[model samples]
Target chain A: MKRILARISYDGSGFKGYQKQPDARSVQQEMERALAKIHKETSWRSTSSGRTDAGVHALRQPVHFDTTLDIPEARWARALNSVLPKDIFVHECREVDSSFHARYDAVGKEYLYRMTCGEDYSVFKRHFEHQLREIPDRRLMQQAAGYMLGTHNFSSLSSPRTAVVDKVRTMYAIDVLKEGNSWTLRFVGSGFLYQMVRVMTGTLLEVGFRHRRPDTIPEMIAFEKRSAAGKTAPGEGLYLSQVFYEEAALQKHLKTIKKP
Target chain B: MKRILARISYDGSGFKGYQKQPDARSVQQEMERALAKIHKETSWRSTSSGRTDAGVHALRQPVHFDTTLDIPEARWARALNSVLPKDIFVHECREVDSSFHARYDAVGKEYLYRMTCGEDYSVFKRHFEHQLREIPDRRLMQQAAGYMLGTHNFSSLSSPRTAVVDKVRTMYAIDVLKEGNSWTLRFVGSGFLYQMVRVMTGTLLEVGFRHRRPDTIPEMIAFEKRSAAGKTAPGEGLYLSQVFYEEAALQKHLKTIKKP
Candidate 1:
């Protein structure tokens, strides 16, 4: 058996989400369907770096699957892309060791939220960005984001339905950049709970609008209640930009999997 | 009565074309529908700077319409945008002189064609660009484009179905710019014939690929036959970027229609 790791990118407009559901369309279901066609099997299971909500796009999503078929790693991307929907694409594929778990081996993640602070909405970028009528004070938002750059209990930022017991996570960085009439917020963290990034962005936007002071961010995080956070930003504006793993661990896995 | 001129933008994926047809969904039809709804009338007519083919997008398509309703110029954009579809946007609207014509008074036009010379196709930009596996020689393409920058009989570059008697036109400039894996071809001209820009781009691509020499461009133009030129590029990759008009002429028209 061979383990394959594939890097993917998807529009996410046509998908319900990344995880599979019984009836609704999903990225996972579509991927499994394509794999079934290639492997000539009824079903196949795969593991992803993480799950993204409906309408959330991905620039680079990693996934792993075990297969017995003999095919070159480079050919796998071409083979799968032929049968997959136009919205989903596989950019790279390579053989990996059996011990490399796509979810467990991940060390960090980066999420991006895009917004257009223009009075007139853009026709072409409507699907990719959230539009606001007035520009926000990005400097204030940046000050508020500084408070979120450390270990904290992110329960206030996560969805109330989150089932995880440990809500503590380390935030590596948060950057707010403005280009023309567009604002982009990037979040790098050890891990994010369900809807955590969206909630954090919404809270930062409130600070940018001067509705909340920058000093209140630490208070919100310490509250440890979902009600303490601001409204969740829309899913369409969020993207899973990248997934990070330890280079040394990955190299060791690759070395063990090489043919003697 | 008031004449209104609006700068419009649209994603052409949902539109058949810019011109109105009997049973097809065109951008003109959508604009007229929205205008009728605003005017509380059953029908309305509008004239655009020019017609764009089906699947050809427009970044700033200038259009004019006559109305008896008394609405402020600045409010027109807001009111019309409320009724227009999500894919169509009215960026700017203002009162113009009745003597102004959208198509007849235009001095020049600029069209943009985007191409991705990358192995992997972009999911988000699939509707906006043409993807090719091999990278083209941009320097060679630019050399060939220079031959097209002058007054010439463009019958060789236009569609055979074009009904215009005047085939001679002046090309102000043709620029081939490359950025990373993307290539953009900008065509500035006094006017373009049916499918002229696409045909020009195709011929340039042929030169870039070394299938045809750069010096052969002048010969192709002088051939005065549609078959002499290369194939027409796809409509989805084309965009009407801007339309130019003589400021003095527009000012004179505006002054004539001004209330005493």
Candidate 2:
């Protein structure tokens, strides 16, 4: 058996979520349906690095599947794209060893949360950004982020319904970038608990707005309860940017200052 | 009765077209429905600057309606916006005399046609651009635009289904601006017939690709037949950028050379 890995980008507004449910539309369902049509097999399945919530977009999500067909490796993307809807695109695909697991082999992941504090909401950008009525203090948000840069039990920053038994995770870096009226928060972590990124962003935004003190982050983390954190930011503004399987690639992904 | 004119922007991918039809979803239907709900009248109607085809977005389309409600001038936009769908946004509004009309009083119009030549199609841009596989020459397109300036009967550039008897229209300016891989064709004219801007863009592209000569534009217009021109460009890349009520504003819209 041969395993093939495909990197895809999706506009998630048209889907309910990335994971498969019994009654709702999903990206996994569409991927499996395209595979079934290609292989003429009804029980075909695929495994992804992680699942994104409803209305969350992705730039480079990877998935792997085993098949018995003799089609060329590069041609898999074109063949699958022919059957998939326009909302999803398969841009790259390659063959992988049978021992490679798409989910278990991941070493790091990156996420981007975009928030905009414009004079008014934009019609064209209603699908991809969190709109705020007032501007937040970038310095306060940066100060709050410094407390979350190391290993900790993130029980306060995750949903209680997450099925994981261990909530301890390591944060590699957090970058705050501001351009015009929009602010983008970049998170690099070993792994994320369910809804962790959104909760952290929500907490940091509160700190920026002066609703919470930046020094409160340590107590929020040590409380080890979900109620200690701020609200979970909406899924519309969250994006799964990349998944890394190697330490070298993860280190290379960090942003470096440029000399003009 | 008081007349109010509103400037709106919409993402047309969610609607069938801009005109009101019996069965299909339309921008007109949504606007009138929002008005009806706001005024408690089922017979509210509106008139627009012009009609756009299906999948054509608009940045600053204007519309007017008469109402007996006592809502303040500035608050009308907020009231209607409260009920309108997210895809359509009302950005500006003002009170006008009853003599001023939205459709018949228009003096000039500007439309933009955006096209991109990329190595592969982008998934995030499936709603707004015309994707091309090969790059077209910019100099050839500019040379062809020279034939389309000034007063002339643009019969070949309009659709045969246009109901207007007088097809003579004055062309003021045609600016072809290229930034990176994308080309923006801006058209400023006294007025346009049905599908005229799209057909003109399509013909210029054919000239850029060497399928037609630049000097052939005169003969194509003199032919007085729609078949004499090139293929009709799709509606996906077209945008109703603005409408002008005065000659001075129209002249100011022309492209001016910048001093670096």
Candidate 3:
């Protein structure tokens, strides 16, 4: 049995999300199906660092799977990409020890949210962007984003869809940068709850547009209730950027990965 | 009446083309309808530098429209963008002299054709690119492109759909640049015939892929017959980049540009 790590990218528009479902399309299902074709009935299970929602995109999503196929590591990428849909691609694939787990072994996750303060997006970029007609104040958005960094009880800023008993998460940093008619929010965190990024995006957008006070960040975090945060931003503008792992720990984890 | 020149961009995946067709959803038809809403009860004439086929995209397609409404020139861009579909946008609008014609008065035109030599494209960019499983040789393609530069009878390299009687035209230059998995063919010319760009791209692709030799270029030009060139490339990978005009000519066109 050999463990493998793959860096993937996908357009999640037609998917239910990253996880498998009984009757829906998903990144995991597609990846598994592609792997099955290459391995020829070999059982394979994939674990990802992030399970983004439908319509969200991924620039650098990392996943690990275990298989007993004898193919060389170099052939794995070409093999998988040959069958995967054009919207999903494996950028890099390599063999690793069996102990690596894509999700449990992650050290950090980074997400990016884009906001366009215009009526329309660049024709070529429409699928990856969400257009908002109202203009937002950049300074206020930046101020609000700054307060969002550090450890916080983010119960109020996370979606209620998931039952996360402990809502405390450490946000290493949050940066809101503006350029012309667009704004990008980069979130670096140890981990996140369900829809946490989108919820934070919405709150910051409200602050930028003057609908909420910049100081509302503290109250919202302290509230520890869903209603205290802003609305959920649209899924189209979100992207799962990177999944980081400690190299020393990763090597050990890869040894126990399962194979057919 | 005022004449205005607008720089527009569109994802042609949803439209029949840039021209207005009686029963088809066209970029022109949509823009006309949207503009008519602002200039109620007024019929306006809009013209583009050229028609881009369905599924083709544009980065700087120039258009001219005549109107009699009283809206400011600066507001025209935002106003039209608001009513346009998410895939199309009016990037800028400025009053042009009465004599300015988007097509006839242009001094130069730039077009770009993108092709990917990979199994899959970046999910966000799939719609804007054409995938070619067989990688083409760039050096050979560049040699063929070199033969295509300068004055020539392009009738042999154009599609039968072209409506022009004169086949002699000058192509200032053709630049083939490769970036990672994608190859971009950029053409600068005085003008292009109907389906000319698509056919040119096809012939170049054929040569690049070794289906034909670079020497075939001069032969095709000498043949001066439409059947001598390669197949027509798909519209999905083409873009009308920009239109250029002389300052004096632009001034004359601006005077006739309509308001609102």
Candidate 4:
């Protein structure tokens, strides 16, 4: 069997997240169907790094699948893209080690949330950004972010709707970059829980709004109650940016950003 | 009567261009319907800079309409956005003078044609870009562009299917910007013939491929025959960047993009 790794991006506005579920449209289901057509098999299993909810968009969602077909690595990418819907695409594909798994062998993941305080937005970008007409205080939000970083139990930082057992997670970095009225928050960590990043972002936004203090986040984390967190940020602004695996070589697969 | 100007953008894959035609799905028809809803009557008249063909996208397509309603300038932007389809959007809307017209009052227009020679594209951007795996020679294309700039009769550069009687047009600039494997051809002209920009891009692309010489363009222009030009570039990659008007002060009704 040969393993293939693919880096993918999608609008996600029309999908019920990344995972396949009955009675709903999903990127996974569409991808698996496309794969089955390429491999000409009925039982092809595919795995992704994690699940993203309905209406959430992804810039780079890594997935790996094993196949026995004697297809060239480049042909697989072309075939899958040809059969898949226009809204979803597989941009890059390459062969990897047989032991490499998209979810299990992953070391870390990165996410980005884009927020804008503009009174109006271009209809084209409405599906990708969260519009907030009222400007928020950045200084307060930054102070709150400082408290949320490092190792902590994020049970209070997630939604009550989530039912994950283990709540402890380490956040290596959380950087909030602001440019005029637009702000982009980036979070890099080992993994994320159900709606964890969205909830954390909402809590921080409340801090920016002066409804919560930056110093109060520590107590919220200690409470271990979901009610301590702020409202979950809209999924439209969330993006699963990158996934890292220890077994995979990063330099060869990463896209280079050329300076103008 | 109040006049409103709207700057718009769209993914035209699902649209039948920007005109209202009988029994065809057009962007103008959709906008007219939306306007009728606001006016509480079906009678509506609007004008656009020009019409874009099916599957042609736009970064900025200007249009103006007359209405008697007293809606604020910003509210028109928001209101139109709310009712517009997901693939189309109103970027800006402002009140203009009654004499303002989207087509007749135009002084200049700019367009862009993106051509890619990449191995493959991300599935997300496939709709917005044209893919051509082979890199064409840029020097030859640039040399040909120099000859095509300035005043000329564009009769040879248009489609035989067009009904327009006038063929003379003045081109202010034609530039080819190369970034990595993608070459984007930009044109600024006083006006363009039907499918003229696409044909010019296609012919210049042939020059880049060495199939045609840089000097052949002038002969084709002098010939004044539609068959003299190369094939029309695909509509998917064409964008109407901007429209300039002589009688209008652009900043007088600006709601966004602060003036210098």
Candidate 4 residue-wise lDDT, B58-151, digit = tens: 7768889998899999899778877777778888898888888889988888788877775555444555667777788888998999998889
Write the residue-wise lDDT of candidate 3 on B1-260 in tens digits: 99998989998888888889888999988888888887884545789888888888888688999888878899999899888787788888999898999888888777889888865556666678877878888999989999998889888888766567888788876888888887888887777888888999999999987999998789889998889999899998888886768745433433332121
Docking class of 2: medium
Better of 2 and 3 by TM-score: 2
> What DockQ does each candidate score versus the true complex, computed on alpha carbons?
0.68, 0.73, 0.54, 0.41
Q: What's the TM-score of every candidate structure? A: 0.90, 0.96, 0.78, 0.85
The worst-scoring run of ten residues by lDDT in candidate 3 chain A lies at A251-260
Pairwise TM-score winner, candidates 1 and 2 = 2
Choose the strongest candidate by TM-score.
Answer: 2
Among residues 3 or more apart in sequence or in different chains, the pairs in candidate 4 whose N, CA or C atoms overlap within 3 Å are: none
Residue-wise C-alpha lDDT for candidate 1, range B1-260, written one tens digit per residue: 99999999999977889999999999999999999999899999999999999889999799999999889898999899899999999998988889999999898788999999956788988878888889889999989999998899999999989679899998877888778988899887889999999999998889989999999988888889999888899887899997878855534543553323
Using DockQ, give the best candidate's number: 2
Per-candidate RMSD, Å: 6.2, 1.9, 7.0, 4.7
- Candidate 4 chain B least-lDDT 10 residues: B251-260
lDDT of 3 by residue, A91-115 (tens): 8899987888888888777788987
Q: Recovered native contacts in candidate 4, as a fraction?
A: 0.66
Candidate 3 C-alpha error for residue B20, in Å: 4.8
